[model samples]
Target: MSDEEYKKVFSKNLLHFLEINGKNQADLCKYIGVSSATVSDWCNGKKMPRMDKIQSICNWLHIEKSDLLESQSADSASYYLNEDARDMAQFLFENPEYKVLFDASRKVKPEDIQFVKEMIDRMSNQNG
Candidate 1:
């Protein structure tokens, strides 16, 4: 992504993380030792934090700086997963019901073999 795109994504992610962490702008300002206005600018995406402030913000939010920035290094799992494994992992991770389906398939039904085969086929087709 372009730098501007990355910045926008980072800003949105930061705002979401802060909100989830129960931090308001005033709390973030105090935690990062920045002016309330500066925190406001960041929350609104009016300005990007400086490197030092970014580090401080990451520390305050209990996230790594790379994760806040959405840097490639922050997503090691994605990097390691091959195309097929990535697709399978994404599908299974999103559907908790599939875990039961998979476990039950292994213990008793020959139909479970067909179900897994169908899942792999569907993923391959979607990717193609």
Candidate 2:
């Protein structure tokens, strides 16, 4: 990636993991022995850290370097069986109101999964 693109990707990933792990810029600064301003620059996409510092942050966050460096394809359907499954998963994560679908699905039979989908489709059709 170009330098600007690298900054944006790294900063986005850094902020994502920091929030996931309940960490803030101050916590990162103390751990990496950098000033708060330096951490802020990294978090805000103003600058990129050196390789050693990237390794340090990875160790601190218990994540692989690729997790910090690479942008996972949010627009692609490579991992899932299809695009709809991926879109549904993203929707479920972004909207906690539908969390019961997830909670209930865990105990549901594999054969019943399609039934639930059909039920949803029927309900949506009725509403539409």
For TM-score, the strongest prediction is 2
TM-score of 2: 0.59
After superposing candidate 1 on the true structure, give the runs of residues whose Cα lies further than 4 Å from its correct spot.
71-128
Q: For residues 1-128, write the lDDT of model 1, one tens digit per residue.
A: 87676777777878776764557888887787889888877777677888998888877666677767774445454421245544544465577545433332112334444468588668768999
Tens-digit lDDT track of model 2 for 1-128 = 79999999999999987875568899999999999999999999999999999999998877779988989677732333445554564565686645445543222343454456567768878999
Against the true structure, candidate 1 reaches a TM-score of 0.51
Global lDDT of model 2? 0.75
Pairs that clash in candidate 1? none
Worst 10 contiguous positions by lDDT, candidate 2: 103-112
> What lDDT would each prediction earn against the true structure?
0.64, 0.75
